[model samples]
Target chain A: MRNLLILIAKYGSTLLFLFLELVCFFLIINFNKSQGEIFLHSANLLSGKVNQQTQKISDFLRLEAENDSLLTENARLLETIINFRIHDQENNFEAFENKDSLAIYKFIPARICNKTTHLRNNYITLCSGKNDSIIEGMGVISNTGIVGIVNNVTDNYAQAITILHSQSRISAALKSSQYHGTLIWEGSEANKLSLITLPKYAEISVGDTIVTSGYSTVFPAGVPVGKVLNYSIDGGGDNYKVEVELFNNLNKLSYVYVINFPEKEEKEQVEISDGN
Target chain B: MGTKWIGLIIRLLIVVFLQVVICKRINLDYGILSFAHIFIYPVWIMIAPTKIPRPLLITIAFFIGLFVDMFYDSPGVHAAASVFSAYARSMILRFLEPDIGYDTDHPFNLNKVGILWFISYCGVFLLAHLFFYYSVEAFSFVFFYEIIMSTIISLLFSVFIMLIFILLSNPKY
Candidate 1:
């Protein structure tokens, strides 16, 4: 018993060290599964914030290059969308192209340099001009819907009259019944335009989609105009004045495409002497 | 005797602070070595009075390493490393002892030993400590290459830092 006591006294601290290490191993193995995750997350949060602060320096240096890449990516996506539309039309027998007819519409991509939606005669200036084959009477549209018709052109830039202009008129129709009408904007509202000349017999309802009629050589047919919000009939009760919510918001304009209908000029030249 | 313990406690606090606060945040990753961790806390156990009981020294080493593990967010690894180091310390001390041997209450310190002898003593212990630390941290033999590289690189840095601390403070424990 005395020898055992002496040994206990001699090796007590070593036992304690072994015991504490066992506890540490227990904590490391067990808590590491659950609490350790939270602990590491909090620690990483501290270090992550420090990294973010330092990363800001490198991020600022790469900002211009990043912006250039993002813009190029956006352009590529837009081009892909245009190609998909062309492919879709090729497969669609009803909307199939006729090479002998007028001319195929080619989209010329352009960025909006300036726009004014508050004015009675709102105009949108595009980056593309006469140099890019953009001419007066060419129609402009965005990813959303029809935007405006080309009104003037310079060597480097072109100005188009927006759909919100009071004088600007577009031929559109009810998608379901094919009842055609003229889309005109009142001077008061920017986004809300009225579809006039829609026959009363036409199947018109709230939320009915209005699309360009393809009757005019400017705007293509089936370009989404907007949904029907409300409509009224005149005293004659023959035509509908449809309050339409436009898809293209001029205030949010960025990139736009000018659609060139090649047959327009030749057909118009054969009829009238207007070179547009 | 009590003053010796007081000095030890003070050194413990300073070493722990240096380990947890300052050394923890150093962005030391370079080359194939993942971390250049400089552990100065093991020096607290290394330079204790040669006459102290081996078990007591080992226990203290365990606690010091456990304390560091709490802050490092990796429990058990430092404790395992420190305890191993402390156990190995007794053998190394016995091997490196002078013919005259050590006197009770007279601890090894920079003032007591020649600089070259002290540096070699610190280098051997720190290398072992760092090797065990990285080995336990990796927790797998798959990181054999990593463990060796980290241990070698960290040993160089840790020993240099330990030497600098000894040279500057030159603590008498």
Candidate 2:
């Protein structure tokens, strides 16, 4: 007992070192609480500012595509107004009838400020946030298709877990057959994601469209994910490893939309009750 | 030894700043060489006070590493590697002792301890430091051979940088 005590007293410094290291390890593991949130929030803000500056510099180059989308929107609006007017004219003869087919959804534009595709858990930052009602878990979509899911929100900015993240498991389905599979990133490729657990019998082919399964409230039904690039079989079953060519060229993504589900709170209550 | 402490602090601050503000933004993908990281921060362990309390030294090393980790968005890697080096610093010093004993508690300088001793000391420390760092960063031995190769290359680069810093400071050997 005396020898043990003497030994402890002699090597106390090493013991202290071990203790400090363990404490540091614990802190690092549980660093996700509030400090991480603050870092991500600030990073999002800074990245957003940089992206905005870059976008302004590059806006002149994308004018043609922006003009094309605007023209298409304008044509659709004109056609809707004309059709509504004609229907109202016809309905006037049938006494009282409501004839308004106004579009409900409006795109709240925000720029992609910061994004990463190489990390295990990738995330993106947008220029818009709570000031624009860009709450957590909102769907961020580009003009081409789905971009990511919002995971953090501050007063002036929001951060998103992009489709390229290894941890991003999005519910997606084949456009033709509607066979649902979980879309996952394989941690190495930026231009591809693995669509796993697909049954072999499903008549899948290259160039087939992939879209959101709408299993979650975050994204609406039928938001495009990517086109199927390839498939293969594994020992367990026919695991189709899809090379998803993302719609939003993540490298070039500048603008996106933050979507809000009006019935989100009600849905959450229902989900909680269901769980219980 | 006093100047060494000042130099370590200054270099650490510069590395953290450069890594966070500069290197974090400069990722060039070269296939197998995926990312070329320049780690000049371990100069702290390379020049720390030889006789400081081991626990306090480890704690100081941990915080310095943790600060770097915080800025770079990678958790635990720098901290783990730095603590390992801090723990091994005294051992390396003990091993590199020549026929004449190091009388002072200060670090063995190039002039006092000879160039070969300093080189071997720096090499061993760099090897241990890089071994822990890359192993932790990779998190798997599947790329066992790759890890070994990367570790050697990284150590060589780190040693080159350390030599540059030591030369620039022109510390009284």
Candidate 3:
């Protein structure tokens, strides 16, 4: 027993290293499999707080740029409102009948407290959550284009799976031909996305605009998504895979709009009945 | 003795602050340079007093790495690399032993060890740290090419930064 103690005393460092490394590998594997939820959550919360403090200083410095962008967005929203008013006047007889369509999507503005763009699966944290009427599965968009969908929420903060995430599959269509496709990230460049399942015969070209299809209750119809960068025939040779360049830079996002679709529950209930 | 411990703690705080708050934010992703990440945190373990017990040194390295990983949003990749390099440090010091030998209480400061020896020592450990870091980060041999490329590129930048830091501080302890 004394000899064993001597041996341990001599090789204590090596033994400790082996043990520590074993623990580290355990963490790596478990975290990769997403089974380290408690660790990840607490880590995120702590880091989120540090990032929030840093973000405040940078946010103060970028106030002028933020104001300029907000002004342009305000002007664009005002123009849309004006157009709606004109359409309502033109269809005055039908306007009263379809009033629900006029206010289908309500936008809840939130600031991005923290985000990451380089990871295979990226997530964004917003400064608003359940207390602010934000909920899981609500679609998020910046002033420019689609940001992500809300995945988790606390009392005051929420997490979103950005479009850059591998599992993010947004329904999109060509603005010109209206050919439907699934938008997905290929885990390479930050700004590029792939639109798959587009029919081979669809009229597609470089610079063709892509927009939300409104098939899902998340995003409204005709929201700007991206522009086609290139296209190729899928391995199956039955569909066209078009590379899309997003309008939103994503890396520089500061503020976003969480889409609130009030009729989502009603639509989902109807779909469930149909399935039954 | 108490002062020495206090000095070490202060240096630890400074190094951690520099790595987590400053170096973490510096994106060197200009065209074709995306793979080069700056990591000087390993210098903390490298510059520690030579007489520190191996078990204690390894433990310090592990916790510091885990602290950095929290900010990077990666759980264990950094800790694994740091531990590996910390384990390898003693072997490296033995290999690079000078004719006069080491003063166990003092750190291998640039002035004490001379430029050539200090550079080689830092370079070798930085390379080991970064290689292990990228390998564990990829977590698969399928990305062998990516792992190699990132290690070499990051090594160059990290070594350069280490040289500048050593030259500036030239700490005796």
Clash list (residue pairs), candidate 3: none
What digit string (tens of lDDT, one per residue) describes model 3 on residues A1-276?
999999889999999999999989887868754435544676788999999999999999998788757855663463344235434545553453345456556667788899999999999999899998999999998768899999999999999999999999999999888889999999989999999999999998899999988788787777789999999999999999999999999999887888887889999899899994
- Candidate 1, residues B26-85, lDDT tens digits: the string is 765666546577788888888876667878788788888889989987778798889888
Model 3, residue B97: displacement in angstroms?
1.7
Higher-ranked by TM-score: 1 or 2: 1
Using Cα atoms with residue i matched to residue i, what is each candidate's TM-score against the true structure? Answer: 0.50, 0.41, 0.45
Candidate 3 docking classification: acceptable
Task: Name the best candidate (by DockQ).
Answer: 3
Two-chain DockQ for each candidate model: 0.20, 0.14, 0.26
Which candidate do you rate higher for DockQ, 2 or 3? Answer: 3
Alpha carbon lDDT of residue B47, candidate 1?
82
Candidates in order have lDDT scores of 0.79, 0.71, 0.85
Error of 3 at B156 (Å): 1.1
- List candidate 2 segments past 4 Å from native: A1-8, A27-276, B1-8, B18-35, B103-106, B171-173
lDDT per residue for candidate 2 within A1-276, as digits (tens), equals: 999889778886677667766765565545634434544666688999999989987887887678657744643443343234434544443222222333222345677778886677778898788998778877777767777899999998899998887677788888789888888888766767778877677789999988877667776557787898887874676666666777667777776766666666787789989994
Candidate order (TM-score): 1, 3, 2
